[model samples]
Target: MSTLNKVADVVPELLIGAAVDVVVRGSDSFIGDVLGVESRYAQLGWLAAINVVVWIIESASEYAAGVLWRGLAQGIEHDLRVEAYDHAQHLDLGWHETRPQGTTLATLNDDVNQLERLLDVGFPAILQTVLNVVLVGAVFAVASWQLTLYAFLPIPLIVIGSLVFQRRLEPLYDDVRERVADLSGALSANLSGIATIKSFTAEDRERDRIAGFSIAYRQANLTAIRSSAAFVPLVRMAILAGFTCTLLLGGWQTLDGDLELGLYSVLVFMTQRLLWPLTDVAEVLDLYQRGRASTVRILALLAVPVAVPAGTARLDKPVGGRVELRGVRAGYADGPDVLHGIDMVIPAGETHAIVGSTGAGKSSLLRLVLRFDDPRSGEVLLDGTDVRELDWDSLRGSVGYVAQDIYLFSGSIADNIAYGRPDASQADIEAAAEAAAIADFVASLPEGYGTWVGERGVTLSGGQRQRIALARALLRDPALLVLDEATSAVDNETEAAIQSSLRRAGERCTTLVVAHRLSTVRHPHRIWVLDAGRVIEAGTHDELVAQRGSYAALWAVQTGEATA
Candidate 1:
């Protein structure tokens, strides 16, 4: 019914178009008779006035419908694109990991545009074509039933042909849409990894990959085009067949005096006016099928279930950031548990670190703390409350996470710093930057805080971006701060600066650090050593190092010892 309301927006145009056909045909018949009569001047004046009035209505209605439909298309496009994006945002990290960014972008942009095109042109064309048939057929039925039969005889064939074309075109259109998504994905990957491609001198390889996707896209479109191209000619032939029958049969009746000349003129004019526009219906139907295919894809994306639903409970007070994981077993889909029966606790305002080798699931533990994914067994708690029972927004608001691979949005430096706290003042922004040891670097830039970071913060070096991300987390002033290899990209001086800042910040909130650089974790209140997804050791840095275990071995490797 909402879709029907959109059709109503163009109803005036449909009505005027049908009315214009009637007026033009009726006036032409009247002109022949008025010229044949004695009072030709008076009749000509009246006919001229009627034609002018109808033309004004036709022109005004066409303009109004065009404007209205475009506005409606833009509004719908905005809503659907936003809704798809918001839904995707709420989905679990695991879900995002399995989906390609380019495919998701194509669904949001290309698919929505397809529907917009249908609204802009296809919907109005269909409505007007329908009005022409029904209204013109009614006018013919009243004048002569035999002529109506001849006029509408080929309509069924046209409809049958349209259906056949639509049926064949649907799968091909679906193929076209899929191929476009594939091409978009390939293009996005190649563009994003252009630096890597150049370093490896693999431009030709990447270009070949993109070319294959492009060729597939072209072939899919060609297949759909081949079928769609056949339709206009078929509709024209159907229109010709109907028009020819009406002309020959009506002309014979008129010459034999079985039908009046004025009626014959009107019938001939209406037949051409009504059925000829059906030729355009082929293009309209093609637009509709393509739009329908795109709609299906968009709806499928919207239908993806949110694996991690948000909780409704709000905290009685602000969270104090005491986090605990109780026998929490979790993993990716169809994979063994990354965190197997892990039981741990971090008291409020404590600083702890987790250090492990590759595939030891160090980062996975932090993800659980953030509730990016729920445990397959047991529960994660925040401040003695199960995280699954806490309001997700409240839980998230009380925690700040800095990932290993920092992603800075395309915006000013101030914008990126204030991303987690949009309403932060300039002083607060500068203070956070200073805390992250990035204030001097920012101030040195000509644009300073106003500097625009290119897409993915390409304007900033890796260490700078990491510092900016830390500043963003600091701006949030969260009760719990999780840093995953936060200083990995920075030089030792910057790392020392960040570590100094963290030492001060850790006194105010719980801090969990996942670091490969042993220097960062050496002073933590406690260190957890992970081996094969299990916590094998937990103690203060000195205790763990003295134990001569996994943590001791890792420290020896980092401290330049010859052997464990």
Candidate 2:
């Protein structure tokens, strides 16, 4: 359909070119004799009819070309946007951690959107200009090469001007694209953190921050527009020069009987049509250059390699659910080592707890075992296999993780609980809820498990959100479990309730908990005290307490028996 539609305008251009040749030949003889012979009059009438038909054909083709090109361009734009979004979500947690969410969002939304605007207006203009050039240049060459040479004097100027515009505009457009992305990033960050802005009474401050980016973007666009605006008047002057050359030179040829009057008329009309159309291309090139800049960003985003390749292992069963980290040297891309040459192992069916002060690398430890990121050196092993080598889906499927910040996709209670175990039945969901001690609360809801939790589970209390996240993990029934900061934000009663459930978790899977409050993890079979990225002490909770070291110190501090 698109190719056929593209042919529409081009076909008429050919027809018009051929008709002009025939019309020039006919008009030369009949135009002179007002009382031309009968057969000649008949031919003149037919030529008039042919001219009318060609005009209609040209108009219809142009309309068709506009619709087809614009529609196809939009389709391609939307496809790219959807693909970028899908790929971004599939990327690793490490990628998200390293880059700002606002930047990626800007590429997906604003950058892709810019391409659509360019394609919608710019591509059709290019097509019309190209066809006009071909048809007009052909007519000029056929009439007289000398006259054609004079008419064609501006060809190199148009070409040179477009090339100059392209070079100047390409980088200007790139800067414009970057500025737009910066503005979008700033806007997105402010909007997402609007609550933080309000709480700090930093609304004015954020507004200033956004205004800075907006001004940069506005200035960048103005720079590009300024270049493009100069293009027209300059091209118009060149066009005028070409037209003056044609008028002065062609008039001499006609008067000297060197060229026919009708052919001269065609040359003048064709030259104006050809050169005028090209001037519009300069403006269209501006749009095309901008779109090219925006597309490169989008394409670069798509080109980002998936750092964590898909693994082959799928969790079939974890009989023991043991975990071990051996010679682990871990750090992020820019940071100092968070964990250094750490060796530790958890026996199957044991509930191990980790305690540490701020920036002690406790959470980073779990991330390695979960394969959210690979350790810089050494191995994170689950069930005797390096977690990195295991299929990500399989490794993750076999382990249930509830992070410090409990996350829930917006959905009904049943939907959120079934997040990890999508195939779980209502009975399974209720059972998982019971395990987390939120089943009764679910029953009391106006819609029970069908109750809708707003975005990120905002409708639920902190404790409720934690339990829902817990239930979500429990529903998966993975052989290994990591409860990270499970009891940090909950009340004592809720903590106790969740703790009671943890005591029973050992029957099925080995569980590791990252503990901050002392009471929740007091009875773990093993407790490891981490300080400045090393395991300074590790033993049974009772033994660690006897040592009166870092773990004991943290315990005392949390229990209010000591300061810091």
Candidate 3:
């Protein structure tokens, strides 16, 4: 369609030239001689009819091209953005931990928009410019190949200059892309931490920090723009040279009776049409370079190997929630092992708690079991099957996990509770909320289950968010229920209620709890005490207290029985 539009666009110039020919030569004009329409008035009328048809074709083709290009741009933008986000979501936690959220977001949003801009306008403009040159040059060649030589003399220089500009602008635009990502990252971090910024009275500091990023981004753009701006003037000079040669040489031929006056006029108008668009090369190159840079980033993100690859094995129905870690050594990228060759097991339907201080690898153990990261050595097994060999849906679907830092989506309380089980009945949602001890609070709200939680449940208290998250997990009715500091945010009363709920829940499923507070894990079937990536003690709470090991020491400190 764009090709058709470009071809149609060149017809009017030919018609104008033919009109001149008819006026100058009458019966000798090519259309008059060939079709035997010798009357000059009739030739003019024929030219007018052809002009209308050409305009209609041009208009229709332009409209079609616009719709097709814009549609293609939109489809590509949507698919690429979704693909990048989907791939990012599946990447291992360790991979995500090393990169900034803002940078990733910039790639997904800003970079994709750049590609859209190129497709929507830049690509069509480039295609039309190339076609105009070829189509007009063909006309010039047929009428006067001698003048064509002069008309196209500067094209090589324009092409060479464009290439040089494209190469120079590539690195500059790449720098611009990086700067934008930095700006996005800083802005995103500041917005998400706006409350912290206010509480710390660091608004000015954050503003200045973002200003710094913005300034860097502006500088990068200016550098690319300065280089890109130089391209047009140089192209214009080349175009001027080409146009001048054609005007002088073609006019000389016409005066010398070696070229037809009509053909000379055609050459003049077509020269401008062809070389003038070359001046727009700068803008097109600017878009192309930016889009190219964005494409590189997008492809790089898409190419990142999934650190935790899914397996082909599916968990059988009636999953036994037996979990075991055998000689498991795990850590983040380039970090010392957080869990060092630890061996442990929780039989199906047993309730176990892992109590450890910060950096003791308690949460790290959970990550391994959940298959967020593969063990550096040995295996994390579920029901005697290595977890790395289990399909993602089967593995994750079977285990319900509530993290230490609770996150609730922007939606109703019921929506959040039923997040893991979206099809869960209202009775089930309410029951799960009731089990997490948040039912009374929901009922107190004017909207009840439909009450909005706001962004990340900002309208709710820490305990409320935690309970809502726990309810979301319980709604899944998972075979293995893992809680990492799940009750840390709650009050003593709420904690007691949640513990009571856990006792009942443990009766039906394998439960693994990680907690800093010794009281939360005291009543579990067994407790494992970790210190420096090693399981230092494991036994019933009373048995550990009787042994007076690391668990006893921490228990003493937490209970205020001793000063630590």
Candidate 4:
């Protein structure tokens, strides 16, 4: 349906190109007759009058066509970009993790722009060439069929050459598109990791790496260039052959008195009009191949299945946040299970902590609750309703998640805090910041809440970024709050303060924390000890310490009684 709308948008502009060809060729015939008239001054005046009318119509149509076609291309590009982004946002983390950010950006920006360029230039060029052929060929036939027949001698060769050109250009242009994506990915990665590269003194190494990718991109373009360069000249030769035959045959026929001088002149001009536009046929085909390549990439991305489909159900009211994982088994898209058949339940309005060794799937548990990655073998339920059966917006909005890797967009601190709840008032934003124990630090800044955080909160400390993320999550006033190493960057004193605040906040919300430091989890309502993707023990911190098992062993290590 959208394709039809897009074609409709561009069709008028194309038809105008055909109309312009008629005016151009018709004026040529008029001027040719004026040149032969015995009343030269009178004929010249009439020719001037005809010129003014044709110019007015031609200029108006040409200008409107350019404006209308460009507008159509822009609208399509905008829609495509938004569709790609909206689809990407709904995909599961597993899908996002498998792809490069650069590849996605390249498809959204570069590939979409390529198609736009095709529409802007290529579409009109093709229309003009076709119109010239059809309109001029018909006019030539009427003037003299013999001359028209001679003019078509090179048509078969041009058609065959174009077919061969397209077949060969497809793969070469596809390669060029792939190389462009690689270059985009490499550049994005380097820019994001510039600080790391500088810290490690790997500037030269990174430069060389980027240069290699650049060379590959250039080479791909050159290969396409080599092929395209050969095309226009060959097409021009075919065009020249047709033009020469018409000129010779029509001139001979005119001298032999078989053709009128005025009619012969018109035929000769029409033949030039038909054949010269073929010289640019190569450019039109180049755009076609490049646009075709980009369209394939864009379509491929759109076709990737949404890993987490939004369900049709909505909550009658807000959920009470009772989360239960029933015999849940889970894994990444391409990996073995990270969370085994783990059955657990956290009652509404309770705080629970998950502690495990590195790679013990402590974080994975929180992800399951948030539905970042779904369980493979069992359902994750919230308030007795399977999360998959709930509307994704309602399920996600009811949970406030803060991960170990904090991401704060470039904006004022207040804006970042209010990101999850854009309608939050200044007072509400400040209250959430206070609850997260970040209000004092924010108030100390020169701009207070208005201070810019820079890209990814680079102006602030890691601890500050985490606090801002927490404040953002807190602003939602979610029924369920999930923190995965949320306070890992804060100092011991700040951690203690935040933990105390969290304890008070948990009274109204269900809190789940993946803890690295035992002290942080010790005061939670319940604590679970995970080992090798299995829940080895579940109880209060004191209960597990009494058992003197894995939890106790970890506590001992943290307390300096055993080696980690």
**Top-TM-score candidate index:** 3
> 428-528 in candidate 3: lDDT tens per residue?
99999999999999999999999988888999999999999999999999999999999999999999999999889888899999999998988888898
After aligning candidate 1 to the native by TM-score, how far in Å is the CA of 144 from where it should be?
1.0
lDDT of 1 by residue, 248-271 (tens): 999999899887665676677788
For candidate 4, the per-residue lDDT at 100 reads 89
The collision pairs in model 1 are none
Report how far residue 101 has shifted in candidate 4, in Å: 1.2
What tens-digit string does per-residue lDDT give for candidate 4 at 1-564? 222232333333323433333344544434435455434444545555655655555666777778888998898989998998888888888788778889999999999999999988898777776666666676677777777787977777988998998999999999999999999999998999999999999999999999999999999999998998898888778878888988898889878988766566566666666777787888888889999999999999999988788777777566788989899998887789998999999999999999999999988888878878778889898888888888877898898999899999999999999999999999999999998999999988888999987988898899999999998988999999999999989999899888987888799899999988898888888998899899999999989999999999999999999997
Model 2: weakest 10-residue lDDT segment is 1-10
Which whole-number lDDT from 0 to 100 does residue 197 have in model 4?
Answer: 100
Better of 1 and 2 by TM-score: 1
lDDT of 2 by residue, 83-178 (tens): 999888777788887777778987888788778878888876776566666666777787788877877788788789888888988889889988
Please estimate how well model 4 matches the true structure, expressed as its whole-model Cα lDDT. Answer: 0.84
Hey, what RMSD does candidate 1 come out at? 4.2
lDDT of 3: 0.92
Among all candidates shown, the one with the greatest lDDT = 3
Off-target runs (Cα >4 Å) in candidate 2 are: 1-68, 313-320
lDDT of 3 at 396: 95
lDDT of each: 0.85, 0.80, 0.92, 0.84
